[model samples]
Target: MKTAITAVSGQLGRAIANRLITETGKDNLIGIARTPPKANDIGIEIRKADYNNRKDFDEALKGIECLLLISSMDHPQNRIPQHRNIIEAAKARGVKKIVYTSIVGDPEKNGFSPVVKSNRQTEEDIKKSGIDWVIGRNGLYIDPDLEYIDQYIADGAIINSAGDGLCTYTSRGELAEAYAHLLTQEVHNGKTYHLVGNPISQAQLAKYINDAFNTQLTYKAISVEDFRNNRIKDLGQLVGTIIGGIYEGIREGAFNLKSDFEKAAQRPHKSVPEMIEAYKQFRD
Candidate 1:
């Protein structure tokens, strides 16, 4: 079973590729990225493929039996077209199956609607392409906590607009492992799996952080405007707008959906406390 992973230079892609190498073999895996040198170094066949270039995708997808279409990191306007190009290329190449990484929510209803909109469109296209497909609607990742930890500690609080909103946070590594299992098993075809861990409110998350670092911290619920302003002050407007939309999505109950993550992983999924504990070493 010859398999290809798009965006192999990315963290999730790299994790999935590494797992595939262990499960199948390096010889059967192809790593597609805009820059192929890093993937090449990993001993997988490297192919230069850019989501923006149809020819690049076409050439890279050739001879692959299955493809993992990692969503493009571009803005929504640019991302949908790029996904379309890849889906067309995969269809033309006679690829047997495709597994797409999607977001956990109804695009039309989510606070971050544009992102989920693009993902939904791409999913629809994949289904219409007549290729066997699996959609992994991944939950919000806990990794972002690492980036915001310093601020949280300094402020003695984790501030957000999501008031009592619960999010099922899964680690990127766990999500990648689920993708690997989905790719290796034929039974997963045509199914949409929600790859998420147990849900925890931001208040609970704050408690976990406090416990891990031995500090007194709180979860402060702020207005959307206040949160946006604070984020803008800290990270500029554009990034602030993007992140604000994520919290808005949480507030709208987008990330509250349940999942079969344990079943998909063939083991228990990591909890928020466990994830926080692992990061305790960086707390001092």
Candidate 2:
């Protein structure tokens, strides 16, 4: 049996690809990316599958038994149709299973509802598509803060619209490991799992960073409008709007969900402090 992972050049894609390679080996895994050359180093067969091109998926997913559909970062308007392209192609190509990396958000409460709505639509479509499917509703990835540690110091604090609301933070690496099992196991079919660590407020996140990297920082809550216009100005409108919207959801308590990570992965997720300690060792 063969498995394919889409968006293989991305951070989450790369992490999942690596886990698949380690757990199931490279011969059975295919990395699907828009630019095949970009993921050439992942030690597997790389195939071209642009989300916008329905025909590309027909060719790329050929003979694959299972698929890991990493959610596209395309604008919400474009996502549903784009995802349909693959789901249709998967059926045509006889791909038996598809595991999607979706997100956890309250569509009514989240300013990021547009994106969440699209994902939910895709989930419904998948269930109706006559194919075996599993969906993982991922929490907020902790990578942005980890990557922005230096900037946090330069700015003298961590600032966002998240306020005192708890964010369900999980790491890409941890989620990837779970996805490897999700992609391969039939037991997870027809289920939606919340893949998250314990929820933490922005100030608690700062405290973990301080404990790990030995930096003093505080969380500053700001208005969603201010964040879009000022704090993430460098990210431009599209991304800044989406990110600002996510923080707004955080502030509204949309992300404070309990985890089903153990049920999904058959193991408990590591705590924030435990993960931070591991990160510190790697950084050192």
lDDT score for candidate 1 against the true structure? 0.85
Give the per-residue lDDT digits (tens) of candidate 1, residues 1-284: 89999999998899899888877888889999999886776778889988999999889998999999999888777888999999999989999999999878657753367788988888898899999999988898887875678888898899899888888998777887899998989988998888998988889988887777787889989987788777778878766766777887787788898788876778888888876765454344
The collision pairs in model 1 are none
lDDT of 1 at 191: 87
Off by over 4 Å in 1: 109-111, 233-237, 278-284
Please provide TM-scores, in order, for all candidate models, with all chains considered together. 0.93, 0.96
Tens digits of lDDT, candidate 2, 121-150: 999989999999999999988877788999
User: Against the true structure, whose TM-score is highest?
Assistant: 2
What is the lDDT, from 0 to 100, of the residue 151 in candidate 1?
A: 84
Query: Considering only N, C-alpha and C atoms within 3 Å, which residue pairs clash in candidate 2?
Result: none
Local lDDT at 198 for model 1: 90
